[model samples]
Target: MIEVEGVKIDTRHWIGGERVASTRSFPDISPIDERHLGDLDAAGAAEVDQAVTAARAAFPAWAALGPTGRGAILRRVADGIDERREDLARVETRDNGSLLRSHRRGVMPRVAMNFRFFADYAEKLAHPGMEVRGHRERITYDPAGVTAIITPWNAPLMLATWRIGPALAAGNTVVLKPPEWAPLTASLLADIAHEAGLPAGVLNVVQGTGAEAGAPLTRHPGINRLSFTGSVPTAGVIAAAAAPNVVPLSFELGGKSPLLIFADADLDLAVDLAVEQFDNAGQVCLGAFRLLVQEPIAEEFTARVVERARALVQGDPRDERTDVSALISRPHFERVRGFVDRALADGARALLGGGPNTSLNGLYYSPTILADARPGSEILTEEVFGPVLTVQTFADEDEGVRMANETRFGLAATLVTGSAEKAERVSEKLSAGTVWVNCFFVRDLGAPFGGNGKSGIGREGGTYSFDFYCDVKNTVFSPAGWRES
Candidate 1:
């Protein structure tokens, strides 16, 4: 909790291993009921600069710890997360309106697992050198000084740790700028990091609007690497800011990914997997927004999908029975509603839901399905980022693959087919960063995860993250008799 001008708020940013307050504050409202949850301190240029300076000062010592030492600290952090899992999950639910059940059972567990995976990987990591004809060369990896990590409002803690775990494991100091809408959990994470014995100034959290905090952090010359997860337009802005300093960036942006359901797919399995589009209220970057069903079974597949979507429970996010929750804010809720309204206006047919669920208060939109949506419509081509699915039909395998790859965004794609050969062939042709065969959200912690084209910039997760957060330098040692020319 924080106090500003004699008023108390529920959250505060952590910088230099201490709770910090800002002069200006922003209202933190609950999407479930629009109630005032708290006042979040607004971190601007000054705060961002302070956090970066602290990280920059802390980098040398953190890097000197070596991978094993750093891994040990990370392991403790992982354990700390597990110890506070329930508290963390509840904070996340209150901040972002994600269903408490999902947060506890799914998101929070993944957060701890991510830290543990990276910690173990860091200890086992090897940067082997080679023996050349006349010299022995050694390859080494070093942290990239200060890394500025910006995460979105959806799944705040899980996504932030996705970058935080690997960056810290590789020994880079970080300044994390969590979304203002969901800043609570990031602060909690900072507390946990400190309690786990993370060195002072090793990790900092700055909270504010994108213009004030995010833009300055991205453009700060002190930062060595920039890692961001958000929309495509925002990524472009971040890229421009980082350009002047030549700061390398790893972007995990938005997607309108496709799910290809072949004629031979198991109908039950296919429908279940496709319904994952509504998980986290469809705010997931990897959620399948475009469904391409084979023409032969398109009707049956769409019917089942609609039925399942309709059956999903929609109510208070805290309720264990609720399957779907409200959007993060009123503006975002309206924006998602606008996408559906425009689609319907442009001649798209809503097979299930199309607009806000006025029956209930707050920001709730029904799980929507638009059948026979025009290929070029806004809803079909753009990322709705809501509980909405726009579906189309493909005649055969060739057409299915073609249509799946048609979108500019290629973050993730799904192929539901019984034949292994067809799955392999189509997976190869799909231009997505990750392809799931007969699965929806099953992710391997060690696998490379990112998108191609507008979806994202670089890969993360596993050793791939180590590549982004560190610099690999080769040291050459000539034979004892050799001399420099």
Candidate 2:
């Protein structure tokens, strides 16, 4: 285990396919107690250069491995992840303050499944069909030279694996720049890659702040592709930096997604899915933050949802009884709290909660539900990445759909309905990349995950994700009559 700030974790930055020690460092805090979990060292610019050089050095050979060999390695990584699933879940719980039950029962399973799904799905990535009507025509798919994967603090390890699994399965070397705020889990996973026997320089992990580590990695001339998951502003900068290099990019940005429930919907099922949508303190990029109910049943639904949210047991992540955990940091906690206060000032009432749990030394906000919320409030319009939900009521189907679509962000949205026809209609009109029918967060490892509009670009979970990290090439075969040149 790597020791830092009184907490020891089995973490290391994997570079050139080996675990390397860090030189410069900062404290890794546990959201639970605001105590120093450990000191995680930053990967200096020199380290980034080394990682990039290694990725470039190994690119040609790895790209030449063909889909079969590349797929095999990815499958093995999936197998290894499953073998160490408990370790991963434990580390994630401590590192991120997510409930152990959720990590073990839900998150870990999806992560491993995603790895295997991509391993098999990569083979189905059919090459473009060619035609030689009068002249020769051909199309071939190949990997982008090197991929720089920058991950966020929320769901760090899982999100990184989703991108890393597909990129490597399609044979692209990777250099991961994890959020310095949430580095341990992702770093540990990379170290595990070495233990699983991946080739040197094929994968690298650099832990540091975005400006120093992420910016340099994105702008690095040697890097040929970028896969990022974070805020929209941050993505704008990354995209601009990579534009000069013309490196292909898959960006999963912010979301102000809406969850709609009609008067005819199943309230019990809606409650369960609603909680799932707000899990990880509503820190995920998928459907979270907003709750829209038909005004006819609005009062009843709000009461039920508030009771359920407040009933949630919040405590140490390690405690099996804990239903929720701490927010990532103090500034984040203050930001969310400040938003809630302003929301109240704008004529909103707290249906459930809006308080700090002082039991924890660090940042901790109670699961909150607000009612009588209007569109003008920032809480209703912007993405609130915390354990908070703002309720907005609409009169009819058209209004609900319009309200759901009225946002700059459209990553994912959900509709709770009994009518299959209505669900399909809503799905078609919704601006989100993925629209869940009767379920808010029933994520499948095999399904494609991404966004449209300001939520960012490209998919990241299955074979389609693999296509994003690769460059397509066309080869024409001539029987001595194929080329006019």
Candidate 3:
């Protein structure tokens, strides 16, 4: 255990494969009870520079390892994560306020899968050569020199792996900056990577607030590529920093995704999905914030959704029976509550819950549903990023699609329909990067994941991820026969 500023912390930053402490540190507070979990070292500009320089120095040897060699290490990393899955899951849940059950059954396993998937992909990656006339041309995919991966607090380790797995698999040295709010699991991951036989300086971690560390890291000349997952405003700031340097970027920002429920859809599944909007306290980027129901069954659908949401148990996240828990922090909880209050003042009726759960001492808010939210209302337009759902009715298929696409965000959308033809047709018309039919949040690691418009800038996962982390160069040379000529 380590202490900074009188507060005790259980973790430290990993720099050049060594544990390092920072001059300044901040307390890590648990949203579950507003308790001080520990103190996290705040990486300032100096630390950021140190991390970047280390990554840059290590890039050559790591890249020289070739895909097969890198893949072997990545596979070992996956095995390490699996070996420590239970402990890592608990750490993540305790640090970030995510349910223990989610980390155990879902998040931790996916972290391992991410490494395994990218390891296999690295081996299968090929840059085939082509013959044009008498010249032989070949395309080579080279790792982007040094990469900076900034992950969000929502799912720290899981999301970090999303970037780390691909970046390392492509042979790029990484300087990962995990969110200060939830930095524990990331620290653990660094230890696991080292144990998996990753060379010193190949992977490094910096921990601090966005202003102190993130800004300098983004602007650092040593970094060749940047991948970020967070809010749009933050993305803009990062983009500006990278602009002068022309560093390639991949951004996965916020979303106010819509879930359309057609007249002929299964009511049971629709209600289940509607309640899922409140999952993770509605902190998910791809969460369904707006519900677009066909006019004929609008009233019934809303009623069922409200009923199901009200039934969710609000208590300790560690409890197996608890369905809803505290928000990430007090400020975030208040911000989410403010959205509900403002929407209510704007004449939107609360169909179920609309206030904090006073019974709970922590930052817990009740699952809320707003009915008859006007077009362009804040509740309908802005991202609440909480357990709040806004319901609107549409008369026809075209109206449903229009209402669903009304927001500037185009990250993800869900459509439930019995008709196969209608599902395909409506999915095509939706502007979101990902469109789900009869399902919500089902992920395939190989599929392209991202958003269109204000949602984000580039895609991640599968070939898309591999392409982003690499620089594809084409080389042409004269054929043997042509050289003779």
Candidate 4:
């Protein structure tokens, strides 16, 4: 057991409702200061097969419990999460270098909300019923057995439960493979669910790298459905692995999402949202790291945004005053810095931070802004996935919309405009899965959420979530005594 912020956590693979003994382990390093937290027990192919076998054996009984029965247990899991919210939040912050306050106030609560909201929705789910030409049709959703959920590291627990909640609610057994970088909270959650009386093997967590554990899980023939949120390249590999079994796959991949500021927009709100790109040190998959502004207000808006970006505090993530913290690791920090270095070398001007934070130490890249970035520059088009912002100006509404829709990624976008008409008009043209108007990161649990093209393959939220986690079956019958042909 390893203790983080007074919370004792088990860092091991949770399979078959118990912590499995490890043949090998990987070091868990804290991004906060590069300290060794613990050694996480790694699960190889054998352990993954054990998990799948367990899940398959338990699937029938778990699914026998209808949505109402499943929901009752899920609510208890939510209660357990609420009870340990602070402990989970503190461990997540220590593991991932995200803001402690944000984790406490927002992320951890959302984790609990993910379970509770999906539980309520599953209990109240209504399938379509219709009658035509004296024939009645009843549509039913049956749980897809043995779902494999692979989540990213940025927002570990919240994203994991975002998929896990619906899968479990729909009465499907799950084998979750969390990113190796931040895998501790998942172990904590497995304990919470077990303590809440979740059936054995109903929810299993296999902890290891993609190659060792995740690859096996994806390829396991028992997985009826697979949901993954990560890089597009990695998604491709998972797709190929799951192809032989013909598994149903859902992906929420990378994003170079745009934040478009129209001329009629509120400058202060736009500026604030622009600086929000630095949130989580820009590790967020949906962050609008690319800033496109209308030429009329680009100068004023850019100035205000740069001033605000400069004022952003960069320090220990545990500090309440700190706004930005370290990147996930030294390699990620170097990758982010490399993007800025190349952009500057290619003549993109740095309006604010240009490189690592010299004042502070350990993987802290200053919140960077590179203005006058060439249209097709790598910095302008690619995902930095760090606290680096690239600025570009558009002449008019047509150009603004065109620029915003230029990226291959359609994960999300933010549009700041005062006029509802323009908000309606411009949002329609942007090719993103979700669009925010006059705000950023405002989410509704019921909304259909996913991306188009390379960003992702399918949506997951509310009924959309159930749609992925369950299979639909249509039952048609002749009305009254009508005879079938």
**Highest TM-score model number:** 4
lDDT for 189 (candidate 4): 98
Prediction RMSDs, each to the true structure: 2.7, 2.6, 2.3, 1.7
What tens-digit string does per-residue lDDT give for candidate 2 at 198-219?
7889988888888778888998
As for TM-score, the candidate ahead, 3 or 4, is 4
Name model 1 segments beyond 4 Å from true: 2-10, 480-485
The segments of candidate 2 whose C-alpha lies over 4 angstroms from its true place after superposition are 1-12, 132-137, 358-361, 477-485
- Mind giving the per-residue lDDT tens digits that candidate 1 earns over 341-390? 98898889999889888787679998899987777778888998999998
lDDT of 3 by residue, 194-214 (tens): 999999899999999999989
Model 4: per-residue lDDT, tens digit, 1-485? Answer: 88887999887788888888679889888999999998988999999999998898889999999988889999999999999998998999999999999999999999999999999999889876988898989988899899999999899999999999999999899999998999999999999999999999999999999999999999999899999999999999999999999999999999999999989999989998999889999999899998999999999999999898899999999999999999998888888889999999999999998988998878898898988887888998888899988889989999989999888899999999999999999999999999999998887999999998799999999999998899987899986885689
Q: lDDT of all the models against the reference? A: 0.89, 0.80, 0.89, 0.92
Model 2 poorest ten-residue lDDT run:
3-12
Better of 1 and 4 by lDDT: 4
Candidate 4 Cα outliers beyond 4 Å, as residue runs: 480-485
Q: After superposition, how far is residue 93 of candidate 3 from its true place, in Å?
A: 1.0
Backbone steric clashes in candidate 2, count: 5
Look at candidate 4 and give me any clashing residue pairs.
none
